[model samples]
Target: MDKIEFLTEKAAQIRRDLLKMIVNAGTGHTAGSLSNTDIMTVLFYEVMDIKVDDPDWDDRDRFILSKGHSVESYYTILADKGYFDKEELNTFCQYKSRLIGHPNNKVPGVEMNTGALGHGLAIAAGMAKAAKMSKKNYKVYTLMGDGELAEGSVWEAALAASHFKLDNLVGIIDRNNLQITDNTEKVMGLEPLAEKWKSFGWEIIEVDGHNYQELINAFTKSSEIKGRPTLILANTIKGKGVSFMENKAEWHHGLPSEEELAQALEELSSKGEVI
Candidate 1:
């Protein structure tokens, strides 16, 4: 298989793993996790400069999932990368398991505990600034949910990143539109989203979140940019791989029933073929 086909199959596998994790655990943020799988796959497998065996290496690139509820997807990628044993995934969300409902620093590849929506950008900005202070070349990437944009803290961090000229910081907003309660616009309008980020002094790039080429190009371009942080508005479907759940807000935190899981697995497996 070619590189693109490989990434696509990898993404499909990640989605399959995500469903299994959520089903086994009996709960998880489904829509967001599935929607963000493609982006996370590209980052972990192709973009980020990470060492699985040496996860805490000083110069390694940092990734913070601001939308921490989507961590099932993140955990799947980490395990696939050998950051931890794949068997560990079976213990996800079980009693006393390190893989809880959100990202925690205790996890090998997790940088911080996040699930409070808007705080990730701030934490990522701090890490970027620390890299600059220590003269490190590592970049800091953070992914936020579009609904999380309603929080005042995200904007505050955006302003700080620009003011400090942290070009090494990249903020990606998963513009899946759907949130836990409903569509983001209905919950809190964020239209003119690109313009809003631009106004905050961020360099904006919009792309189809599921497309490997677009995502890789956007992330590569972020590094070439100078003086300001880049905010990538990744337009995506909420429950991307499953037909029934796509764009439906009801799947935000819903668990798939046994039949639904079987159907979902079939759909994903069929699409794993090389293009």
Candidate 2:
């Protein structure tokens, strides 16, 4: 595959992985994982400095899925990247399975176990601070759901990152507009969201979450942000790739039926071009 085609194919595979895992589990978070599919694909395949062959590469880039419901995508992408075996995904959400609904620190390549909202950014901040203390060059990147911003702790962490001048921390907000219940704006507005981050002393970038080029651009620019943390407001659909599920809140934790699964596979196999 060409470089661009390679990334696209891998992202499609992650989408398929998500669909298969969720439909098989009979219950899992599909929409949020699907929403950030391309973002994960780009991070694992291109953007991040990770060594799958060496899972504990000390200087590797650190990623925290603060929106832990989206662990489905993280597990799939990590497994696909060989951070761990693909077979482990088959045991997801099973009784005593390590692959729970949220990210667990026990899992390889998983930096922390997180399900509760508002926890990821603080953890990322701490890690970045640690790296700074050790004078390690690693960067910490974290993603939070737009709806997850309602948590007060997130702002607290945001304030600390700026106060500490932790430029190594880069945060991303998945602005999918919808959460499990309803639209984010209707539930709790994040209008002037960018400005809010700016006031907190963060350098902000807005981009289309589904665009691999945009993702790379945003991350590349992250290294240049100085004096504090950075945030990327990634505009995304709730369910990004599949035709039926896109922007549908029902799919937040909803499983795709057997037929719907088949349709989703077909749609993703089309690679966002056409049937």
Candidate 3:
């Protein structure tokens, strides 16, 4: 198989793991996880400088999952990256498990324990600044939820990153439009979101979050740009793939029923194409 085919299958595997794990765990942010599936896949598969051997390698780039509740996808990707046993995925939300519902640093590959709304950019800014001061080539990638960006800390962190000219930082917004309670437009309109980030000195890119090739291109384009942080506003459906869940706010934290789980599995296994 070609590299693209390989990556595509790997992405499907990640999503497959995500659905099964969420079904077994009985609780998780399924919609968010599904929405960011391709983004997480491309990052671990093709883009980042990371390895299972030493997740904390000083020269390696970093990934921070700011939307931490959507960790099933991220954890599956990490396991695929060889950070830990794929079997550990079964421990999610179970007693004495290293794989919690959120990304924890105790896990070999996670950079930070991040469930809070808007703090990742700040932490990423610090890492980027540190890399600059130390003259390192490492880059930092942070992913956030559009709903979460309503927090004031996001702006503060954005200001600080721009002030320091941390061009090595790449921030991605999973703009799924739906948060836990309501659509972002109803909760708080970040309509001018891209312009806002740009005003804060970030180079911005907008793309269909579910498209693997577009996501890869966006990530690649991010690496080539310099002198400013790159912020990608990835427009995505709240719950992707499964018909009943897509764009439904209730699925934000809903656990699929046994029947629904079976249904999702059947749908995903059908080799359906999504544009």
Candidate 4:
């Protein structure tokens, strides 16, 4: 099989793994996790330079999930990449389990305790700036939800990323229009979003979040940009894989019934195999 096909299959497996983890745990941010599956899959499997056995290795690429509630897929990808045992997924959300509703440093591959939203970009910019100060080549990547863009801190970090000229930092906004309470535009308008970032002195790249090719091309281009940070505005469906869940805001914190889980599994399966 070709590289795209392999990545596609791996993404499907990631979706299945996260779904089962959420369904079994009886709670999760399903829609956002599903939406960012393809993006996260590409980063972990293709783009990021990471070592599963040596997660803390110097010079490794760093990734922060600013929208940390969508962490089901994040944890699953970490375990699948062998940062931690896959069996730990079964204990997710249980009392005293490290895999709580949001991501924390307790997990092997997680960089910071996130979930409050809008803080990831600031932290990532700090890391990237430190890399420049220490003369290191590692790049820092952070993923944020579009709804989180309303946070004042996000723009402050954006300004800092540009002012410092941290070319090694890449920030991605998951442009899924729906948030927990309402549509993103309804809650807060972010149109001319790309222009806003460009005005802040960052290079802007727009892409279909689910298209592996577009995502790959965007990351490649980010590396070539100099004297500025890169911002990838990834347009995405809130619940991409499942028909019933697609674009529906109600699923933001919704739990699936066993029947719903079975249906979703079938939809995500390939050749009758989820994994």
Candidate 5:
């Protein structure tokens, strides 16, 4: 298959895998995870330069899941990429399992422990700055939830990234509009979000988060930008691919029942051409 087709099918399967993993674990950030699956897929499978067998190779590009609660998709991608045994996903969130509710550094491919929100940007910026200092060409990518933008630290990090001219740093916002309790705007407004980032000296690129082609192009474009960090404002649908759960805030951290799981699988499978 071609690149776009390959990415689409890969993302579909990832969604399925994360769903099963979450249901088996009996807990997860469902909506956000689903929402960001496509973005994660593009980065891991195509955009980023990574080594599955040597996850910590010095020159490998870095990925930081700042919105760590939505780690189902992230973990699924890592397992699929051979960073760990895929079977380990079945133990997610279990007592003593390395795969807990959020991104954990103990995991083979995880760059840093995150989930506190607003801290990922700073950490990623530091990595980018370090790369520049060491004269390494590797890039640093960070994914953040739109809701997380409310934290003042995110802006502070944005300012730092710009001031240092960390062109190697790429920040992506999962602009799904919903958080755990309500709409992102209701919880905290982020309108003109692109302008805010621009004012902080970031080059903003907005795209359909679920569209493979747009995502690929945006990531590619980020690499070509110079003297400033890039921010990809990815507009996405929370609980995407599952009809009943789409855009519903309740599913932000909901565990699917067996029947719901079955229905979701059927829906995903119904897209015969994709998965």
Candidate 6:
């Protein structure tokens, strides 16, 4: 019942919620959602200074899911945190449910609507700049997929974030390596990723994304940095908690069959309960 163990259990439950929501809805980005679950868990549950009861608090921290296809993880965490009713999760991806395939501003805790990829960092940069202008103490964080880095817009935003010295901005790359089409290297090479961010004037910190302690340490260190944005290269596994789906590109966007859902739930149950 310590911090690490608690976060671990919360991650497992979120993954379970994601799998069920996707399977029931008959659609979702399975691998990316699962891969980003731990990072989202730590952010919403521990790292970000958020108030579930008052999501629009003027000084509350802002988070953008730039790799918006991973909305399942974000939504699951929001619901669990009381940003909205958990039952609303069942309406995901339905004809008119607010919880669609990607993050939507209509959702209580969502900062902005995103799904286009490569745009989140830029938006986050603007938010960070606005915070600085208003002299707000809140931070702006955005999570992007490794594949999304291929877009020139991402680099453009990176340059802007550095030039402005937005130390309150944090960018996290979900370095799971597997995108929808293939491995990131095969689709679009982004090797020496840390060096690339460093060159962009970011304080780069690489860590095992699934490890709560490592994530907490990285986020904590990010806050102490000055005069530069921080980029966390979160090395993670695609379809992280599910054995058959792990590291598989096909699971990037797919629906799990009944048997698959059962197996995934059983695997999550073995990890321990969310206390």
1 or 6, greater by TM-score: 6
**Two-way lDDT contest, 1 vs 2, winner:** 1
Better of 1 and 3 by TM-score: 1
Candidate 6 lDDT, 1-275, residue by residue in tens? 78988988989999998899998899898999999999998998899998888989999999999999999999988999898999999999999899989999999999999999899999999999999999999999999999999999999999999999999999999999988899999989999899999999999999999989999999999999999999999999999999999999999997899999999999998986865
Q: lDDT tens digits, residues 1-275, model 4?
A: 77788788888888888999999999999999999999999999999998888889998999999999999999999999998899999999999999998887989999999989899999999999999999999999999999999999999999999999999999999999999999999999999899999999999999999999999999999999999999999999998888899999999988889999899888888522434
Model 4, residue pairs in steric clash: none
- lDDT by residue (tens digit), candidate 3, 1-275: 66576666776667778888888888788989989987887788788887679777889999999888899899988887788898988888999998988989999989899998788888999999999999999989999998888899999999999888888999999999999999899899988888989899989999998787888899999888888889988999887878899999999989898899888877776643321
Among the numbered candidates, top TM-score falls to 6
Global lDDT of each candidate: 0.93, 0.90, 0.86, 0.93, 0.94, 0.94
**Candidate 5: tens digits of C-alpha lDDT, residues 214-256:** 9999999999999999999999999999999999999999999
lDDT, residue 80, model 6: 90
lDDT of 3 at 11: 64
Q: Which whole-number lDDT from 0 to 100 does residue 182 have in model 2?
A: 94
- Give the per-residue lDDT of model 1 (tens digit) for 91-149: 99999999999997898999999999899999999999999999999999999999999
Query: Which parts of model 1 have CA positions greater than 4 angstroms off?
Result: 273-275
lDDT of 6: 0.94
Clashing pairs in 5: none
- Against the true structure, candidate 2 reaches a TM-score of 0.97
In model 1, the worst 10-residue window by lDDT is 266-275
Please, what is the TM-score per model? 0.98, 0.97, 0.96, 0.98, 0.98, 0.99
Which stretches of candidate 5 lie above 4 Å from their native place?
272-275
Report model 5's TM-score to 2 decimal places.
0.98
